[model samples]
Target chain A: MFSWFANPHRFVKLSDWLVPACYVLAAVGILWGLWQGLWIVPKDDYQGGDIMRVMFIHVPAAWLAMASYLGMAVMSFVWFIWRHEVADIAAKAIAPLGATWTALCLATGAIWGKPTWGTWWQWDDARMMSVLFMFFLFLGYMALRAAMDTRQKAARAGAILAMVGALNVPLIKFSVDLFTSLHQDASVITAEGPKMAAVYLWPLLISSFGHTLLFAALVMTFMRAEIWTRRAAQLRARLMTGD
Target chain B: MSGAPILSAFRQALGEAWAGGAGALLPLGFFAGTTVLVPLGVGTEPATLRAIGPGILWVSLALSSLVTLERVFQADTEDGALDLWLQTGAPAAAIAAAKTFAHWLTAGLPLALLSPMLLLMFQARASGALLENMGLYAIGGIAFYFWGGVGAALSATVRRGGLLISLIALPLYVPTAIFGALAMGDGPSSASAPLFLAATTLFALAAAPFAMGAALRLAAD
Candidate 1:
């Protein structure tokens, strides 16, 4: 199914237009989400008034952080079984982007934590620790990929690492949760019976979509850039053969 | 992938690691040294030491396991033994399981044995349920070694891959660390924590070898 991703000409032709379209759509969504979240959303006095706004950014970033890792792992599995360069490339491209979003999630989460929870970080909080482990998982993937001497070896090593990480991440989360869970027990359940007020819910949903779109655009751009870089390297090698 | 005895590789790996004498004891030294440092770094209040005792020891043990992994598969790769094993139709996963179990016997088990003395250093109770603690430590040690073995195999071909191995293995060590630490908590007779710890060990025991095998295949590449 993803064999099309490995076809350089098709990938190039498709991404050439899709890339620009993604960028435009991503910009609009992110801007509206930001504008609505920052200015248009009302302050909820039940929680800390303005600090709650951090949720608009933190929540979406957190969602993307988890999603991107899963995407990387699935791509890695495809490459491991099918030996597709594009799948490998997709996995590689997702690592840094996933890491960046995880960092954002951690930072914004901490920011929200400070005024609301009165601590910048909580060691026992299962969500925070699991996310931090996720950050390290991304770093380990990139480091393992970088240490390899050849493209094939890097892809193979990275694929193995990513898959292992994907499997263990859940166990890590479960273990951490079992020992101690300091985070709120489903904020939606706090007096609201798990039904978020529609006002907050709608914008949060839109903003999350915006973040997802932005992430997709970024990943596509990265994959396209890597494909071009590989092409250039091959062309250079061909030129060298003339010597 | 056969469950039949692959003890020859196990015996071979054990003999090689045991033959290293002083080199083989490096993780033991590293484990004890790191455990002792915790009290020195933080003031030696018995209450404080006892509070942090099991958790710190687990952390040290996890870190020390990295030392055990560097040579597990790398030695075979260097000697061309890895290639031979790949070509011999001997199941890579079974070979990996044998090698890692043997490594646990030599490098990991000693650290598990040493945990009591170190826990004593922290002024924690090493007498009550002493056997239970030892059991938990040993099981957690196996889990650590198996996960560590996967990292070792993945980096078998890379030079100075010790840090990379640690980086990769540490996250995988979370379940064992949590369950092991908690097993020491809520009293010793309580079965839940140990059950969770044992379950984690068994899961790693079952799953990590295939990963190690796949990684060794890549290292062979």
Candidate 2:
């Protein structure tokens, strides 16, 4: 199935409609989520009161941050194994976006932390530290890719880094947990279920889904732009040969 | 089929490193220089130094290990030694392991041996436990080199990869440093820290060579 879209022309044709649809759905979901979260949801009695509104953005961004990397890693695996140009392009496109979401998660987390935990950054917090390292992992992938001279080499290198980082993500989380015992226990979002009321939970869920759609839309745009850029470069090379 | 090539590769790497005398000594010099600068920069207050002693030592080890990483593959690749190794039909990972062993022998081993004295210079109580400190540093230093070798291998084709190598390797080094430092400290937690530290080294030993081998192949290509 993925092999069918491995061709750039097919991918472009598919994404032309898919990207706009994703953007429209994302915009509606995000707008509705924001309205519901900001105005309709009541203030938390135990937590930061109205400031808890940031959770709608913060939680969704954090989820997408991890989700984007997982997506990149999967794309990287596809590229590494099949040598798919589209997969490589998709992986490369996801790096900066993933990094941005990771940053957004960190910034909003810090803002939320300042009020709730009484510190802007907590070194001992496993979630915060692991997320910070996740950001670094993304930076390292981008930097390694940028430093290489050839596209193939860069893609291969980036693929390997992404795979290694993906493997280490679990280890990093575990190590951080072991190295520091202090952590904010999952109160609202639990494995059993979300413990929050429907008003807050619905908005958070919608926002998380909206963020996923937005990320998909953005990735499609970047991948399309990458395809165009490569085409132009090929054309330029041909013109130079003709001259 | 035979161990001769691996042994020769290791010997050649070690001899080349030691001949410069600088590669062997550079990490030590860097370790000592950084240690000296810390007191001057942070003040000679013994209590403060004692508090941060293990952390400073690990950070110094990390930085010093990074100092020699660029040369792990740069010199070999530039001189075609890597190509010769690749042609030997020995797995690239095996060659990487041999080179990393050579690197550990020259750069990491010395830092491990000298860490006790350095710890004393900072008035760290770990000076009394020289054997334990040496053990921890040896394991931790090897882990550093193994992981750093991955970065060095990845960046082998890049021009002036020294800083880039550090940027690539340092994040990977975090677990080793954390576990190693924890092991060196005096507390209830110290018992488990060394075991975890050893686990980290084993993890690096298992993972890095394959990554390095792949990167080296790409560089050779």
Candidate 3:
């Protein structure tokens, strides 16, 4: 099964249908989630009031930010073990999207924090700092990939890096937690499981799924584009050599 | 097989790094220079300097370690010693470990030694805490070298790898920085940070060699 889709031609054909389907599902889910969250859900009494509506987008973006890295790490593993071309392409495709989501998460969190915590940034927030570290990890991965001269070299080096980054992610989170606890303040946010009501929880779940589907769609679209780009380069090289 | 080859590789690496007296002293120089500049940039108020002293020291350590990272594999690879080492049939990870051990000896250890002076200059009062933090710096510096070794190995094939190595390494340095800083902080809770810092170094010891070996092989290819 892996071999069947490992071929770029077959992968492209499959993604042609898969990409559109994912995008459509993502659009519906996201739109519905926004409606439910922004209009139907009651405002929080203790927090930012109507400003908490941003949680609809904020939570999902944050969830996808972490999820995307895990996704890349899994693809990196596949590429490292099997030398799967699609796996490399998929991992490469997911990076910028993941970085963007992470950026969005930070921005939204900042916006939410401004109204709720009276600060645009919180150094003592473990979640915020770790997410920032994750962003830097993404930047490093992208930079390393761009630095390598050959595709295979880039893929292998990037796979190793992704694995290393994956290992460090948890350590970063843990250390940040410990570091923040040493300098404790009365934080508005806690690490406890969501104390949110059903109305808020359901929308968050739906939006999170929507974001996942959206990420899948974007990765597939980018992968298909990358496959074609490689094919074109190969064809051009062949034609030039023949001449 | 005999351990002779690994030992020689280790010695060769150490000798190469120390061959030029200036190269051996570059990180220490950079560490001290950066530490000096911090006060000039951030104002010399003793309380302010003391408050941020540990963080500044760790950042300088991280930056200074990166200054030498490109040379970790670049010089060997360029001169074909790395190729010869690969042909020796020793595990690439073992070779990488030896080389990185040499790097720690030459670059990392000095930084740890120099850190105490900077800490004193920054007006950290507690002698016992300063000594403990110095010990943590030694451990953390070893971890930094190994982590930077992975970056150095990955970018060994690139002609200008200095910036790329920094980009690749500084993020990996985040945990070490956080833990090291926390360990230097006051209170009983801060004591656990050194254990975490040690754990990070141990993890780097086990993980970096393999990652570096794989990346070196890729660069060789």
Candidate 4:
């Protein structure tokens, strides 16, 4: 099944159908989650009412944002080692999407922090800076790829960069836990397991699923476009070389 | 295979980088500016001066080392010396190690040598603690430079890859930066912090070379 889908054309065909379906599901799920989170979920025992609601969006977006980058990084390794065209194409397509998710995570994090932490920004804290670092890493990766003129060379260089930069992901995850970090300790997700009650968790999971599915839909669409563009460029090069 | 080819290449091209002289100027200038000029510009109270000294030193290392990063692999690759290195069949890891060593020798060691002078310029008391903090910065700077090497190798071609190098590298430097500053903060005689810095640097030194070498091969291909 994996080999059958390895064909670029076959993958594109599959993505072409699923893309619209993903978008519809993502839209519905997001809407439903927002409605439940905003109006239905009760106020936190400690955080009062409005402040806790942001978690419905913030938590899910943050989770999916990170997951997207890991996905891209794994695909990048596959492209580098196996010379898998589809993997290469998928990674290239996912970069901007991953970057967008990172941005959303930061923005939502700030929105959440302002109400709870009494401040929107803090530098010395590892958690805040770790997220910032991930954002920079994404931008740096994209900028480096763009600067290179050749497709193969760009892809190879980008893959190496993504792999080496993987170290930052752990930094992002554990920054708060390990150091005298400024960000508050993990409220929901923890080694001991989430501290949240079921009412809050159910909506949080739904929103998280929504964001993740949205990423999947976007990545597949972008990869389809990338495959077409690459084929067109190859054809143009071939014709110019009279192949 | 014999190591003779790598040995000869190292002996010849080692000076190619040194010949540029920017490596020496970059770190040395920052060290002077931070340790000397900043103190002169600020108030003269010893307590205030000592408190800020550790931060200034780390900043100097980061800023000054950056100026030399663009020169890391670019000129060699452009002039085909890197291509020659590739042809020599030296292990990629060894080539990366040699370059990283050359960089540390020129950049890191110079900073180490300048530390006493910098401390004196800041009127930092020659307490045992002060000396230990200086040692931490010096050793930590070298180890941290290897991680920087990995970034330098990866982004060597980007138009403003120098800036990107810092972007990619700064996160990795966080633990080093935090630990280094805290080590110094604990006082010059406090051995624990500097020890941590040294230990962290050793970890970086061991791992970064092969990672950078892989990036070099990817860049070459």
| Per-candidate fnat, comma-separated | 0.78, 0.38, 0.78, 0.51
Give TM-score values for chain A, per-prediction: 0.93, 0.95, 0.91, 0.89
lDDT of 3 by residue, B161-211 (tens): 999889888878988888788788775668788888899999999999999
Per TM-score, the best of the predicted structures is 2
Best by DockQ: 1
Docking class of 1: high
Chain B TM-scores across candidates: 0.92, 0.95, 0.96, 0.86
* Candidates ranked by DockQ: 1, 3, 2, 4
Query: How would you encode candidate 4's per-residue C-alpha lDDT over B59-85 as one tens digit per residue?
Result: 778766665666677765666766778
Cα misplacement distance, residue A188 of candidate 3 (Å)? 18
| C-alpha lDDT values of all predictions | 0.86, 0.87, 0.87, 0.74
> DockQ of all candidates, in order?
0.84, 0.67, 0.81, 0.55
Ten contiguous residues with the weakest lDDT in model 3 chain A = A181-190
- Better structure of 3 and 4 per lDDT: 3
Which residue segments of model 2 deviate by more than 4 Å? A179-183, A187-191, B1-4, B126-128
Candidate 4, true inter-chain contacts retained: 0.51
lDDT of 2 at B216: 88
Clashes of each: 0, 0, 0, 3
- For the second chain of model 1, what is the TM-score against the true structure's chain B? 0.92
- What does each candidate score in C-alpha RMSD? 2.5, 1.7, 2.9, 2.9
